[model samples]
Target: MKVVLQRVKSAEVQVDDVSVGQIAQGYLLLVGIQDADTVAEIDYLVRKIVNLRVFEDSSRKMNLNIKDVSGAILSVSQFTLYAQTKKGNRPNFMHAGKPEYAKEMYNLFNDKLREAGLLVECGIFGADMQVNLINDGPVTIIFDTDSNY
Candidate 1:
């Protein structure tokens, strides 16, 4: 599992010119799932995401987590994070999980986030969607379950 987490003042996703999900003052998560991803990976990532402190606090330091600031979440399933471009001009997606499995993992990831008492919004699992975001502090964090932050 891999996730690109961007702190944003606002974010939204559109499918077929219609807004499917949107959020204000939160994180925009681009999530990728591999075939090997399991509940352990999900739990690990969720725990870190809700607790990672990157928001600015009264001291003007990055000391506040999303929950502390009452932020929301906009999660978008993105398999392309695993794209391999070493060989040629065309990228290979062999590392991405199969669609059926990937969708299941993606849904589970979102459900877990919600279970953590978060207001989570999400894009369609396998749709051609457009995303818009206003990055807060332009602060971004990436998480890979197989590696340390």
Candidate 2:
């Protein structure tokens, strides 16, 4: 599992010209799943994202978590996050989970986040999506289940 978390003032996702999901103020999460990902990975990532203290507090310091700020989440399935370009000219997707498996895990991830009491909106899995966002502070972080970063 891998995730790119971006703090955003607002965000929306569209599929086929129809807006499917949108958020007013929150983090825009681009999620990726790999073959080795499991329920444990899902659980860990959700906890970390919700509790991440990237949001600024009264002191103007990045000390508030999403839950504290009452922020929502716009989760988008993004296999490209796992694109491996270390070797050849062409990117290799061998590390990315197959579509069938990836979709299943992606759904579960969203469910887990919702269960954590955070308002979670999501893009349609396996669909061609267009995402728009105003990145708050342009604060972005990349996370991997394997702690690669």
Candidate 3:
């Protein structure tokens, strides 16, 4: 499991020129799943994201979590996060999970976020999506189950 979390003022996703999911103020999550991912990895990422203190407090210090700021979530399935480009100009997607398995894990990840009392919106699992967002503070964080960065 891997996620690129961005603090956003607003975010929205569209599929085929139709709006699919949107959020007001929250984290825009680009999620990627690998064959080795499981519910355990999902649980870890969700907890870390929700409780991440990216939002600034009254003192201008980044001390508030998403829940504290009453934020929502816009989750999108993104296999490209695992794109392997070692050999040549062409990118290999062998590190990414198959669609069937990836979709299941993606849904599970969103469900876990919703169950945590966060308003979670999502893009279609296998659809071509267009995402727009105003990155608050331009704060971005990446989490991966396999390596520490």
Off by over 4 Å in 2: none
lDDT of every model, 2 decimals: 0.95, 0.93, 0.94
Q: Candidate 2, residues 73-138: lDDT per residue as tens digits? A: 999999998888989899888999999999999999999999999899999998899999999999
Model 3 has an lDDT value of: 0.94
**lDDT for each residue of candidate 1 in 1-149, tens digit (9 for 90 to 100):** 99999999999999999999999998999999999999999999999999989999999999999999999999999999999999999999999999999998899999999999999999999899999999988998889987854
For model 2 the local lDDT of residue 35 reads: 84
Candidate 2 lDDT score relative to the true structure: 0.93
Better of 1 and 2 by TM-score: 1
lDDT of 3 by residue, 23-138 (tens): 99999999999988988889998889888998999999999999999999999999999999989999999999999999999999999999999999999998999999999988
- Which rank order by lDDT, best down to worst? 1, 3, 2
Q: How close is candidate 1 to the true structure, as a TM-score?
A: 0.98
Q: Lowest-scoring 10 consecutive residues by lDDT in candidate 1?
A: 140-149
Clashing pairs in 1: none
Error of 3 at 51 (Å): 0.8
